[model samples]
Target chain A: MKKNYSNEDLHSEQGATISGQQQKAIVCNGLTKQFGSFRAVDNISFDVNEGEIFGFLGANGAGKTTAMRILCGLSYPTSGEATVAGFDVYKQQERIKKNIGYMSQKFSLYDNLTLLENIEFYGGVYGVSRSEIKIRSSDLISTLGLQKEAHKLVSELPLGWKQKLAFSVAIFHRPKIVFLDEPTGGVDPVTRRQFWDMIYEAAANGITVFVTTHYMDEAEYCNRISVMVDGRVEALDTPANLKKQYKTNSMNDVFYELARGAKRADN
Target chain B: MNSVEVINIVKTYGEVKAVKNVSFEVAKGELFGLIGPDGAGKTSLFRVLTTLLLADSGTATVEGFDVVKDYREIRNRVGYMPGRFSLYQDLTVEENLSFFATVFGTTIRENYDLIKDIYEQIAPFNSRRAGKLSGGMKQKLALCCALIHKPDVLFLDEPTTGVDVVSRREFWEMLNKLKKQGITIVVSTPYMDEASLCDRIALIQDGTVMSINSPDRIVKNFPKTLFAAKANNIYKLLQDLRRNSEMESCYAFGEYIHFTVKADDADIVRISQIAERENHDGLEVKQVIPGIEDCFIRLTLDSGQKIMDRKK
Candidate 1:
């Protein structure tokens, strides 16, 4: 909640330099997660500042999700130290869980529940009082312009609306950080744009957003991005800097250049 | 000769009209794209043409054989990859490929050259169960299985929907190579960016074909003066721009909003003035080209307007 570094300071911290201010919402040092003989996340290190949208990118087999699971306290890292919201991942995973919100590629909400009920359920799970849930649910419905569909089952809604509602419910507790994994996979462009608008709103309100997406255009929306290839962070910088670094005009091209050279597969 | 043809194909399920009088032709050796969002009738049309399902009306053919009368022949000449993963997950990669090849009364060595590029990517893990493969590897294996028979035509439905960007690009490259091999390929994808990789793309929505042309022609046909506009408060900028009388449709595109104006340069000045009035700082606007997705949206919106007008 307190600011100890400017945006420029965080940008400098991203490229291999740490100031040790403990101001980052997320800090990873030598993080590794191995499965059998394969290292899914191999000694990755990075820092995500408060309220910044950090884009995590990689191919399908790349270790982005392993690292994310470690950060969210869902999976134990094989080795290395990491702190999320100033709580140690290994020792204070419960604390880390309480402070972070996660939205997987699949919507975590119950499809049969009504919009308001879904909101109430997630808010309750996050320990919000019933009285506060009423006010927050109504505000969320109005904010998303779902007043008409507020009582409808999530299954009856369009894919776009369901995704938006899932996102709103994910952040119902107003966690300090939110992890979004491919939040707009199959939606139309107009709907994808609207979802990104929701993301921008969340980030603007000081929620540290860590998102992974396959859409290169969406990658450009992030404040900074870290790309992984074969379980290593092959590139980390702003989208513009990445484009310059790879000598490519688009993020799609940059991704191809990094991922094409990787020899590992089926691990 | 056309490798595939659909003439006024109409398919329905109960109250839902999945494919409404859709028709298209794929020339031999052509790589065609069926581009649209979810439930756009891509799968239905593909099923009809591939002889897996019957059409309510009209006709379709593959390799000069009727879908109804020559269903057997069509099935033999065309390979299909359904939207969902259909490979046996419990089976090893080698087993799945060999099974597909045997189903067609062929062996892996018989059509090895057809799928050599893709098969090699997953061959190292041939002994591993298909379930253990990653999303990209599974995709490559599914593609190899489809090509093992060396079908004259291939139909893929949303093959790269959930795959990462790198794999999506590689899949397109493989498609291009197959196209050079003279295999008529028709693939569907929800990602609009992949539409550019096809020689020609058919933009469909609500079971209706909105436009069918090269990606460049579709972009060129967008009839509005498009602009990419941005301000400090992007959400507010969108709200303000939508409320402006001179503004046409406006939607967010990445960091900026892609919008259209009523007239020419005057609209830019008006937009800047509106941004200033709304207390938006660092306002900027630039002329931008429309992509296939943008054109698809505009076409669908116009079609909706026409339908409403007819009802009125």
Candidate 2:
């Protein structure tokens, strides 16, 4: 597949295609996760289109993490029908894990390992052939312009470089979907832009991008966004449509409007 | 008198210079910010002023006491909240608060008014273990503990990092209330939007200070006229704009591409014309005022260029 599709092609395709006919990368129907009495995820329903850049947003304690864990097949939902990459999240969790990549700000790469070594390790863990790992790792390193520093310890690289490298490694095995949780936190503005560019490239190549971020600007970059409030998806739509519906000019305002009334102690 | 002062501070770890000749001062009762991303020396500087880590060279003072000579006095008069949650995770919220107060040789009752606003929010979880609290509650508890003694100055390192937007806004509001109580606040954050909330901010990056001024002045001082251009295909528009010889810089800003031109008299028409030549669909261009993030980017790039020039 050619990775040369422009943003126009992506947007036009999204509007032209009937979403019902398109392949669903993720489908959550009445997904509920109950921890004793409290419902962390309260019967949420949504569908993510294949290759779509889906933004999952919520305030603290809004159940975004809990719902994401359920969809990622890490934790089972209490009552729901969901499928990730055409595999049931409940019964086929192992298969779902095999088809997905996950990265979070707190845990992404190994500080002790060198760049190439980390890639080789992850590639091996994902069951990629050693020969293929060698070829792809080199290509990844050169593409990120890290050929000179590829042998240096991951800890020695700047935070921005580490994040970008971590992202590349996460998607290395050619997973069908990638889950990114606050991937650009603490990165500078310039590097943050570069990171989004990498995300765009990934989406163009047909990898479904499921990301969560606190940065409102990043929320605007997604093809569609779902805002969780008090364990319920209060709003879900394209950025432009959300802004229009909320009678606001920015996504920040739209979020504030929906989230300010949240009764959850913002825990 | 200034609440905090630093002169020619330099900290290093082996080959890496964590802080290089950094200097800044925070006025009494002022909300001053050290705005920078991670690894930009904000934490190192915070550690030096809070008397946790000694700088390799140069001196700093907190609450009019020398960090080196009168570390005890400074430690007693200033509260420091490290970037990480430093309270005992196993302890309940109330236990953590009382523990911090006792360590400061003060009672929570003595400073109830100082922390009442923040503490009340977490009071419901008073018996819950610190580790059990959610992210927002943890932050509030940390703030309460830091203020339990009613210190003259407060140093918060990345209090809002990784926090959601709503919680971040609420945290800033709490800071504003604290400022009104005449507490000198010296906080650091990686978010540029938060810079505007501070009375003045020092934009730091890569072990150096880029600029220090009021957020308004910093935005006003942007050297180039910025234009925000949007099209149906923002990625293609970005690529096309980058290729234009007249464009100085082009980067995605939300739904639009913010760019500056090499020409001094660049206008909206010229920007639109350039985008039109690229055959962009639904193209729109407008002159927009620069924000603190824009200024920070410009300063960082200029400083980076200077370093390159020196290397040559």
Candidate 3:
């Protein structure tokens, strides 16, 4: 069920084909995004390997959202090159959008829509066949233990349940990559763990998971992490290596050490 | 006397019970935390205590004023930073602070010392619009506005939810300083790590109070001998350990898996041996001190299971 898009045959003409067969899911080279005079995202770059859960960490106003939007092809980068799921962020945004799933910091599902209706709507948007949608929707609902509340409007669900449903729908299209922006903000620790479980499941199924979160504990779960400080990647490494480098036991300490040294107060 | 007391308060919205028979007391000038997941009634209880929402039953008092009867006095004497950002978006940072100060019949300069540390960080950007400020700056501004009145108590509902680690730490540091000035502080957050920063915390779940204690005491009271187990193929290790009859409960904890032994006498040696027998490579097992989060999960699960068993 895990489809690997590493093969050259799947490469479209919109982006440069990755030469090596290392199968990187996302590649960025000096990616930069600027809003007016402020370089919200300075020259920054990183690669996300297939099936790897990449954790993007930063303080508020640290340009994480800007870089993520650029990577997701929602916004254009000022300079540098990046490819997502083998599609150019600049030239093949349509193809990239079709292949990527995104869950934002805020709830994305329609509040008035029932749980089932929201799932069906997203399925339709992704062009999932009706028969496939039925099977997948049932599977998702069951997996999230939402069978009893399937007909309930999203507005009526608890915050944790809504988050779980939003995540389920994000990956409903079976995209090769999924982007979660602070998916667990204000969520309880138990529900946060459950959300990470979903992320692990998605990554295990070959979907590259890219997530940005303020919770240091959640950042530790990622296979590799990038800490953006003042619009630049202060460090990018395994949580273990980062901890060792900073001589800290927790990701919270590591993030504080890097982010506190930031010279700019506003970004 | 308790600075804040919640006596079996219950709040309901139609069929959903947002806060159910919740009772607690916070000593004056103590930094108290109401910790829980979202929809766990932390906000509902805060609303009741802050005099924003009236409880359907029971009663709560803040600084000797009944929440229902002295709503006006409570409103005047308490500073509240709602979980969501609620500052005037169009007003400049300076303007927002001045406006809040004026509404309270005071001036920012009059109470400047109270929020000096927090306000100074965003002071350079005072001219920036509240909506235009970064999340950290906006929070600092919000805190400044909340403190400009120099109230006797502060009600901060999930103030650090979206704040970055550095800013979050700074915000708590500011809170500690404020506490030293003899102001009672009640803050709510979803982050269990932040629970450790509080003097005492009330863990809430499903609209019920699960436990209330200091963070260290809560961790000290964790009933299980928890082990931090890690190995290559960590997910597979989780599955293998779950099959082990000696393992009581296992849950993923970051890079390592946290599991408790079913038998009280089982030690790390036995756990490592099991991992070894299962052919798990690079097996590392260590007895680790459980944090506030571990305590929270255990307590919440125990309560949930108890309810289920009673239903059965």
- Which ranking of candidates, highest TM-score first? 3, 2, 1
Native-vs-model 3 lDDT? 0.84
Candidate 1 stretches greater than 4 Å from native? A1-23, B229-245, B264-284, B303-312
Best by lDDT: 2
Q: List-wise, what DockQ does each model earn?
A: 0.30, 0.41, 0.47
TM-score of only chain B in every candidate structure: 0.94, 0.96, 0.96
DockQ of 3: 0.47
TM-score of chain A of 3: 0.92
lDDT of 2 by residue, A1-267 (tens): 324334633443343343324488888899999999999899999999888999999887899989999888899999989888777778878767777889989899999999999999998887777777888899898888888888999998888889999999999978778999999999988788888888888888889999999999999889899999999999999999999999988898999999988877444
Steric overlap count per candidate: 0, 0, 0
Tens digit of per-residue lDDT, candidate 1, span A1-267? 323344532443343223335568899999999989999999999999998999999887788878899999989999999988777788868767767888865856798998888998887887667887888889888877788888999877777778878888888877778999999887766667767878878888989999999898899888899989989999999887888988887888889888888755533
Q: Indicate the residue-level lDDT of A185 in model 2.
A: 92
Expressed as tens digits, the lDDT of each residue in B270-301 for candidate 1 is 65665567567777888788988789768866
Clashing pairs in 3: none
By lDDT, rank the candidates, best first. 2, 3, 1
Model 1 DockQ, alpha carbons vs. true complex: 0.30
Tell me the RMSD of model 2 versus the true structure. 4.8
Residues B1-312 of candidate 2 have per-residue lDDT tens digits of 899999999999999999999999999999999999889999999898888899999999897899889999988888888999898999999999999999999998999998988888889889999998888889999999989888999999999998877888999999999999999999999988899999999999999999999999999899888999888877778777887888787888888888888889877887778778888889888999998988887887776532111111
Pairs clashing within candidate 2: none
